[model samples]
Target: MSEDSPPGLDLARLRTHLDAERPGLVTGELRARVIEGGRSNLTYVVEDGTHRWVVRRPPLGHVLPTAHDMRREHTVISALGPTPVPVPATLLLCTDESVLGAPFYVMDHVEGTPYRQRDQLVPLGADRTRRIAESMVDTLAELHAVDHRAVGLAEFGRPDGFLERQLRRWGKQLDASRSRDLPGVDRLRERLAARLPPSPPPTVVHGDYRLDNLLVAGDDTITAVLDWEMSTVGDPLTDIALLIAYTEGEALGDDLSSVASAPGFPPVADLVARYTATSGRDTSAMGWYLGFAFFKLAVILEGIYYRFNQGKTVGEGFDRIGASVAPLVARGNAVLEED
Candidate 1:
């Protein structure tokens, strides 16, 4: 191991595994730096001076089973390799924990920018920003249009009761992550339960689809749709709803923390119209879907807050996360009422 390997990865053990698994993969000493913007998984950029690749693994400890499964992430991304959906080329998957204290996979690292904030997109100018945002929605439509069974992902998830299970699942997660009493969270959950929408035929769903999750090239094209930790073959509307909810959060100015409200980005309505027109799915019940999205995000933030309280999260930017959960709950309530 290098004398200064990052917290989540061990360079020495990684090098040994790479050498044995694929000869000549590493030409010299390996160095790594953790990539930010991902709250659930730890992403690292590894290099041997000349060659570079990206590595992904679960968080440090207290991981939810099924939530951060590296095998699942690797499998779905590999399945989509032949499709129109852009994904990094999967290189290796190391399941043996002895290699890096956890399972991880490495993929070809493509060069592009992940615009997490509006300031980053502002430099690209309004027209370019609009193109990137529109492209993001269109790419999501393309992903939702994929044939899951033909692509060998038919058993990825149960589509029959997907929304129902999702509602119940996030409620339990919220209860488990309770650092303080969230006033409107339960009401939002109950509202979602009272008005569950029947899902359209299932397709591959990117559980968290948004602008920042993609790598945009200088030409305003999305090079890859990263982060498949929450992906599955389920209700595709969940993807669309989540995408809109992100832009809504941006509009709320509550540190929903995405480039969804950037000056040049297309309106969320345009995104919805494009997806509905392309996918031909009924968005009449989108209010329900949007509510579910807000609930899901609120629960996700609460989980992060829980980790921050336990001192399990690494690095900066976590202190303000706990404060965002309540507003998300309120937003969820509003969207549910709109439904």
Candidate 2:
């Protein structure tokens, strides 16, 4: 490992593995740099001068159970490749921990932009931004429309009682990362539990679906959807609600992605309606889903905050993450009250 290589990735070992598994794939020396913006899994862009690919792995330390599963991420991306959903073609799945000190996978490096902030979209004009946002919704619909059984993912995830399991899972996640008192957080979780909405027919759910999670081309088309660590076979509405929650980024904090605030971006109602019209899924119960989305996000942020305080996080902007948890809890309570 070179002195300058990122913390988790060892370029020398990576080159050796690629040469053995997919010989001649790396024609020259491998070089890599951590790709910022992700707070959970570590993403890096690796190149051999002539060929480029993306690598994904678990965070440095303090990994929570069932989170950042490289195999799960690799499986979903590979399964969705044949569908209309745009996922980068997977090249390899390396589970050997000795290779990178953690499980990691490599996929073709895609060319596109992940619009993370309002300023990034302002230059694109409203028309293009609207088109990109709508395309994101439509692509999600396409993903939900895919038959998991047909995609060889019949055993991917447990869809039955998915909502219940999700609430419980996040609750446990909050418990695991409990560092300080987060007022109203437990109440928010209890309220969500008390009013769990019956999920519709299950589909592949993108656990974290938002504008920034997608890669948009110059023509405003979503080239690929990235980050599938939390994806599974579950209520598709969770995906919608999470996307809407991300749009409410003001309540979360400035450090979080808030591309929805950009000029020309479609309103949340329009995006919901577009999904309804595109996927034919009833969203009448979206109020509950939205509240649950806020709660889930709060727990996620709290976990990140715990990790940040413990010095387990990598990259900038994590310092501002802890401040968002309380606001998110407040937002969730407000949404449920309105509902």
- Per-prediction CA RMSD (Å): 1.3, 0.9
Show how many residue pairs clash in every candidate, following the order shown: 1, 0
Estimate the TM-score of every prediction: 0.97, 0.98
lDDT, candidate 1, 33-83, per-residue tens = 988767778999999999999999988876764678899899999999999
lDDT for model 2 comes to 0.90
Q: Name model 1 segments beyond 4 Å from true.
A: 251-255
lDDT (CA) per prediction: 0.86, 0.90
Candidate 1: the clashing residue pairs are 1-12
User: On residues 112-149, what C-alpha lDDT tens digit does candidate 2 reach at each position?
Assistant: 99998998999989999888988989999999999999
Tell me, by TM-score, which candidate is best.
Answer: 2
